[model samples]
Target: MKEYVLLLFLALCSAKPFSRPSYMTLKNMMLEDMEDSDDDDDDDDDDNTLFPTRTPANPFFPFDMLPTCPFGCQCYSRVVHCSDLGLTSVPSNIPLDTRMVDLQNNKIKEIKENDFKGLTSLYGLILNNNKLTKIHPKAFLTTKKLRRLYLSHNQLSEIPLNLPKSLAELRIHDNKVKKIHKNTFKGMDALHVLEMSANPLDNNGIETGAFEGMTVFHIRIAEAKLTSIPKELPSTLLELHLDYNKISNVEQEDFKRYKDLQRLGLGNNRITDIENGSLSSLPRIREIHLENNKLKKIPSGLQELKYLQIIFLHSNSITKVGVNDFCPAVPKMKKSLYSAISLFNNPVKYWEVQPATFRCILSRMSVQLGNFRK
Candidate 1:
């Protein structure tokens, strides 16, 4: 019986070309390469745990009644791969013990309430590149353990309601989401990463208390229609990318609450000026990306950030590089030296800039200053 099961497992493995190796495949490969010795008993015990044996006392018991893989999908261990299958709806035959399901690149339109009825152990769901426009409020009620969800490149205009509170990452990029209600993320205390870029989100669309209950650390709202920074973001954010927007200026109070921010991206916008002390609010910022804007000079407060390493200021209208623009006059106060400072494509004359301007830079190559042709 053990040999029969081994043969069946190998046959299933070789039946398809998997895009990526599943956990079971890697484990089995490692087992095969290990030297056979006195540890064979331990290996056999592990194998039995993975593929259990039928009880000899009840020989007529239906041992093969376990839930099988969906018709056109591949199932191995606790993962189900149904991506790129042109599936119009969720498959009903998914095993009860499935931990992850890949249904990306499908034609599925909407998720019905019972689509994932009994999947209590489900941990992740990938539904990217689908035609999903609506999802039933209780569609994910059974998947309480779900942690990661990918709904990018869908037709949804708003976030799905009643999402599993256990979700840690939610990617809804390239959607039509315009408005965000206050209770959109109410019970999601475990959420940390949110990627909602490439949406048509309005500046006032994010209602107050939109992120009140969450402690999200990373948020990317790039390529949106925001005219000004939304003040409704959680203060626990570490990385905030707002590139490719219509924002015109960075007010002093724009980031007053984000004191723990480490990286801020404002590239490819219409920003013409940054208030004198605006960037100083984020005392712990390590990187700032403000390239491809209409700024005429370096944004102030760069000299106050001791941990700042990279500053992308290229493709701007800056006309000069002051000696104290990036580095503080006192070297002992800087906790980290500048690694990369880009100022290319700006109107600043590189020859007129003194060599002492970049004295605190790690290397000469770290400062990019040429290519200012009009």
Candidate 2:
């Protein structure tokens, strides 16, 4: 029986086995896989669509979410806005890279040193409408990039000391500033716009040469108690607003230094007389606002204003308007109604300048000529 079984297996091995399908053969599958691998080798690494290397997921770290802003302040990107927050003091936890900080309309009573010590990147600071009574000398010394500072509507009695020299605009309007001591803004040569209006600045508070070398473009000391024009105003000033003061007269030397003055606002004052040739010093002067004053006659030397465009002498006690006062500008005035020589509401003779409306007290009455006829 064993021999018979061995003979049968030998016979089956020797005989041609039933032909297996090519798909069911292991060698055929291995050959197909090799062909696919050879085809993949032709592709470049960039064209390969392999999964990207994954970074280990890090859990949240508190330092990554930095607490750079104060508790109640709203910080967006790099600006911190704490206005109208009733904050009595500056939050010391401000970010070092903060660019603009608006702390206006708050109850901040004082600004001490180190309140903004390390903030070197700060540019604009708005502290307007605060109850700031005092500011330490070095309060803003470290902020070297500070440019625009608004301290309007504060209770400050004097100009804050040690202000950043890089400031381009400084406004302290509507404050209780009693005096402007000598060298108050000594090194602020870069200052451009300065507005100290509506302050109770003393008559002699502005020291001589207080604004000696500054290239200030705009200066406003209006609504103060100045009896006379402050001596030695910066000659670089373009627009000077000194209206609403106690100035009784204007001397020739009062404006001798400002040759480039454009707009002069001396209205709402007690100006009774302006020295002869006072307007001549300002050769480039365009507009002179002497309205609501006590002038008896127009200031002499208006003919020298080659660039004079407007002279607002309305609501004054002027009794006369000299022909020479505006004759030099009449030629240009005829071409354009914008060059107004408004002498409205003055007690001057209406018929002197024929065809001009002078009896109209309800409106600003102006002298009429060919161009001014109404």
Candidate 3:
């Protein structure tokens, strides 16, 4: 009888059929389970970010990050300016439509062919003031529209080949170039200005007609190692600066091709003599600088420069000059083209010193009429 009563009491306290838990209690339990799952997912995301399964490191920047230009550079209007940034190579992220690129004052040592491959709109490229030593032969062949290229003040050893024909101005001064090949400027028909001063150019390294068929106006090969004037210079040249070379004399036909030359600078050389009629071809010559040379006497042919304006014979060993040699027709030339002559620091003695105000034209009338030093 006792066992039956205990069983009835247990059945009354136990859960009956079709009975369900409270709705609030079930909702709370689901919320707790979701919170635990979210925590586990957060830890997984952190691990993947640290060691991404897709890549070793993230290649793309965060979407919220801002685009940054090169250090110490300015980018605007599709032009990238990274001058004086101490760059060792050309920046690879330049804008596509960049019209100008100024990479001057950097430490770039070499330029590969693909450096500027896709810069089709680039019109000007300034690479001056860098440590550039070698440029791939086809480095600039792709810059078809490039007009001006400044490669001065560098350590280049040779003139780069395959230059674009559209280049109008190329400045490569103050370099270590030792020679100029025959085809250096072969197809450069539109090249009008070339600055190649301060190079150690070899005497026989220049091939014949290296600068043929160009409209180059000014040529600066000063301080080069030329023992004599290079032949076949362009007739369109207006000014020629060949100062500080090893030339010992000026031949008559040296300048026979330059009829339009206006100024000639041959200073600081070993020029001991200038042959007669050496300067007769340059009738339009205005200024001639022959200072600091081994000249013992003024070249009598210089008197034939009808349009001569000034002649610098300072710091030379000249001993004497004849007034008749330079001014046989002084009365007639005084009205037109008498030039200023500087003879300072020389032992030169003029037998007939005219008035300081007299302007005279040197004449080639007679070589025997004057007692000029031989």
lDDT top scorer: 1
Report the C-alpha lDDT of model 2 over 22-120, residue by residue, as the tens digit: 433544555565465446546545433233243213322234344477888988757999998899999989988899999999999999988998899
For the record, the alpha-carbon RMSD of candidate 2 to the native fold, in angstroms, is: 15.9
Name every residue pair that clashes in candidate 3. Answer: 303-362
Clashes of 2: 2
Per-model TM values vs. the true structure: 0.85, 0.76, 0.73
lDDT of 2 at 122: 96
lDDT of 3 by residue, 1-374 (tens): 89999999999879577856555555555556547655765877654432334431223333323344556789875578999888999987776567899999999999998888887888999999999999998888678988999999999998888988888899999999888877688878888888888888857877787887788888888878988888887888889988988989899889998999988999999999999888878888888889889999777766566677677887788876665555445554432354466766776555444443233634322112223333
lDDT of 3: 0.77
Measured by TM-score, how close is model 2 to the native structure?
0.76
Q: How far is candidate 1 from the true structure (C-alpha RMSD, Å)?
A: 11.6
Order the candidates by lDDT, highest first: 1, 2, 3
Output the TM-score of candidate 1. Answer: 0.85
